[model samples]
Target: MWVFSWMSWRNSLKPPDSLVRKLNRLRRQERPPKREQGAKMGKRPRYHLQGTAFTGIWLLALGFLLFLSPPPDTGRCAPPPTPTAELVVRAKFPAGKPQPPPVTSTAAILVDAQSGDILFSHNATTRLPIASTTKIMTALVALEKLDLNKQVTVSARAVSTIGSKSGLEQGESLTVEQLLYALLVVSGNDAAIALAEAAAGSVEAFVAEMNKRAESLGLTDTHFANPSGVNNTKHFSSARDLAVLARTALQNPTFASIVSTRDFALPPLADGTKREFHNHNVLLGELAWVNGVKTGSTPYAKYCVVVSGSTEGVSLIAVVLGAAEDETRWKEARALLEYGLSLRPRTLLCDRGQLITQLDIGDPLGRQVNVVTDRALVARLSADQVATGTIFWEREARFPIRAGEVLGRLEFTCAGRSLGSARLLAAQSVETPNIDLLLEFWRRGWAPAFLTGRK
Candidate 1:
């Protein structure tokens, strides 16, 4: 059997065309051996077949076929993957997420910094005294109402602030920018008072302004008592409200810069002594990703912090109010942020079907469709932005929209930023738009301007 197989293999081998051509060329220009030159001079050369050379050529061709021929079952695009079907109606997910990885804060919430999507919430609306975290609003109000380079005289009232002083002297002067650095970086109660007084002419007015701003922001569960978050019954905010405040406040480029700074030095007073400020948000150096908003604590408020973090393009904000300890707030913030962002691109916001509010047809036969996306879409959105989006359907899709015809487009946006869009395809073909033989070419092709007017 082995001998038969070897014979079959040898017989199957054909002489390589390239080697045959080379031998034919050699025969036309035959060069004899030195001794045979004299004997065969001027005569046609004999054609000699070399068995060893033929074997080598045949083996080379066999090798090429064995190595170069690809397997018969190769594919065009590697079997086209598992066909990632877009999450349609079934993909709709709720933004009101449950507990996140054992958070330690009493009332905490996580949200997308831009979209305001509430990823997780626990007692988020429960109004509780937020300590120095109140400065976040203070910074916002000042950034909006006060000039950053304007000088503010530190008053005796500011010098007397109780908790977390920025060491301001009664007669000292500083720019609004300098005071903001102290206010946010050190959680300076004194700086907060100075900023409030400077922005509104008095602390009372500033607190009122803060409350008004809260109301304008649609924060139903928030109020402000003082610029510095002293434990006043009136000075309280919910975790959800704080998250909203953080998002709003961070939108100001000046306020965002002040909060995110890890360290800053105050402008020298008359004595030329520079006061160094360090951010109370320890999560900065401790964790690579954590960025600032504020950290607050008092005997009444325990510990509170508003933190934002990001890895890649996905970012998150965590508001933890009333933690047992400062470290607990930081840990809880980190957990909430990580948990929210880990489910990053997996979040499917909405699709064309949910966005189609209504449809109008202009044909004689009124037609409608269960609008769906022609190309299925997977959108990333925060919980808050999901409730609000723009759906633009044509005012009138004149006659004959076939099945799968795009009627309109739905764009998912958050905070004025577009996430993505999907085509609103007609679910079924309308009967009136069906092949109407009565319609003229002029109507179908559109009227020529010269025929209609003096073009």
Candidate 2:
């Protein structure tokens, strides 16, 4: 059976007739002397025909196998991901209520700093990335828990942190106050890390404290996964929550001063080189009215800011998040601040002891007494409210007025609702004229006859 199989395989490799004839012709052309020498030496001569047949068979087999198989895939390269554009969220207003200025931000809010009243908002309670603005809470927590003058040594982990840095070198020593400036003014991620480790002995524990502080401040939509506000799924805050945080932070004098600083210089380092940091908040000097808070940005969070400003006794905190561009956040924040100011415009209606009007004590002689407000009256009214507002006088007592005596009240009312009021006081003493003479003069219903004739 083995011999039969070998014969069959040899038969399968047999060359065609044309190849066989070419081989025969080549053998005939070869010199007889070489064949005789090979025979005499008892050596087996090599045949070109056999080698060519074996190689051609192998090549044909390979070509057949290749033809039967599917082609290998050489995949095209995929394009890199483009950054996502900021979301467009519009605030909804009730019928007849004033709307905030149009802004392009994922979430935004405007609040009255003094009253904590939310003036305007858009998706204000949705949790989203906050970026370096997380330092606001960091500074606040540090101010409360860590001593400003305490010295802290920088760590390797802090020095290796990514994002905005304040030239912090590993093993460098710095005061808490200096790091606070670096954290807020320059949004230094390294400074944030160093402060976190110093405060809680670890980044994890410091983040826990941050969340705890957020919970205490009623920031339900806020969560802190890290001290530096690096891009993390668990690190996020809402516009409303951030505005609330900023308002709380501003209450701390140290925190308030740090965030408002435009430029700060740290003491010389070991190499005798001074490090200077410029605040990332553009609203500080460009808009003279803008006083505080923070600026933040990342690919995920886009650009965000918390802006505080006071104009005409109306203090407002405006937060804009997820703006498409860095400048967009500043522009949107400014618009929100200005719009909030316009919503609740404050006007000085009257100053203490300022004359409001003159009243006639006697009709015939018409002796005038200065009617003044006993206290300053400032009216805070919205656009619609101001449109429906009116001022009126109410008398509480009849005259024979004494200086500084409350004679009446000046009430400011809008839409039948009293906004504010001040007591009307007599600016000077005014004695009553004789009763009989006053009655006779009133009965005449005219100035004295001599004064009328002269006029």
Candidate 3:
């Protein structure tokens, strides 16, 4: 059986003679002529039809790209493009000559209510008696130290106060809110003393607190002799200092409301008679923009006024000290406020998210990182200086780079002086890479800019 199986396998392994001849003939058949294939696979000369098709497609794409219109020319009824990154620009202030203010006050200052930027100044820091505006500080202390609804019994000391009386008598009871109205609206000395006693348990102790508050505020030329703002040689403040004080006071909502009130009727008297009083701040309710604030006058202090007003989302604080007459205080205050509000703020020089500049980080990673400002650059310059300021920057940037790290400062200058400075911080972190890792990153398709040394 083994022999028979071997014989069958050998016969099957041998091919038929006719089939072998056919295979050999097919193998010897000639192939068609071919083009030389240089050193690569699949290389061939282009045919006319193939070339025409490729050229047509390319021309179509090129024509489509060229169809776009060019950008509009500047100053031709079109807005400028929004800038993503920009070089620091230079501008001058007071675009034109500014006329002097019609001011008759001995000392005065105009300031932005929120930023404390002095807009206009004349004898700003020369200390002189502040008169009844002193009550502003007293009201601030009371508001901070006492509860609004807390009842205060008018004392003999409060009733004895002579200047600008609120008509409170001994043993009379009133809430702190009512006393504040009397203090701010009527400019009453008695109301001030009552609030002082209510807040600190005594008038003397409250005066001590007032001095301490002045010290903490860094008022170099301010001293408070009394809470009522009576004419005292020691009780003096500058126009700048008073503006600072009024701006701080106006931040309190209760104080703001009280000063702005045209008139208020008090809680009924003991005999059921209603007590009504009007604001002494003549500007309040008289002008379109004028609001809560204070006015004062004495023989020695002349006339002093601290007025705060807002229009079109901008608030201004104006102070006039030692004006020649009562009318002079109001006229000078209005003039100062007009000047402040007339000076429009410039458009944003640099937006909060806009890239201010680039910081170059030499080698390994071998590229630069972007530095952005943390806040918007808004110029608070006088009317003439509005859009005319120069920008400067710190030229050096350090590593190891970090996101949100403060890198440098952007200073805005005009007339050879700094107007303001904005901080420049890193927007993205870029770490230095080791040589081996850097080479590996490049090999594995790192950014082309990094590899080509195009900062």
- The predicted structure with the larger lDDT, 1 or 2, is 2
Q: Write the per-residue lDDT of candidate 3 for residues 1-455, one digit (tens) a residue.
A: 65566455334443336535644553443232464867445533344334444345434433332232111111111222232323444334455655548777899999988678888899999999998999999999999999999999998988898778867778889999989998998888998989998888888899999989888887889998789999778889898888888888888999999999888776766788877888877787668789869989988898889999976445799999999888888888888787775575444566786686665554334456787888876554443443332224443344456888876666655445444666778899865333334434543554345223556
Looking at model 2, which ten-residue stretch has the lowest summed lDDT?
A: 69-78
Best-performing candidate as measured by TM-score: 2
Residue-by-residue lDDT tens digits, candidate 2, 413-447: 44454556677777887554333344344336633
Choose the strongest candidate by lDDT: 2
Each candidate's lDDT (Cα)?
A: 0.71, 0.75, 0.73
Write down the lDDT that model 2 would get.
Answer: 0.75
Evaluation by lDDT, superior candidate among 2 and 3: 2
lDDT of 1 by residue, 130-203 (tens): 98888988889999998889999999999998988887899788999989898999888999999999999999
For model 3, the superposed segments whose C-alpha errors exceed 4 Å read 1-95, 345-455
Question: For each candidate, what TM-score against the reference?
Answer: 0.57, 0.60, 0.57
Q: Residue 322 CA error for candidate 3 (Å)?
A: 0.8
Give candidate 2 misplaced runs (Cα > 4 Å): 1-98, 351-353, 356-380, 383-455
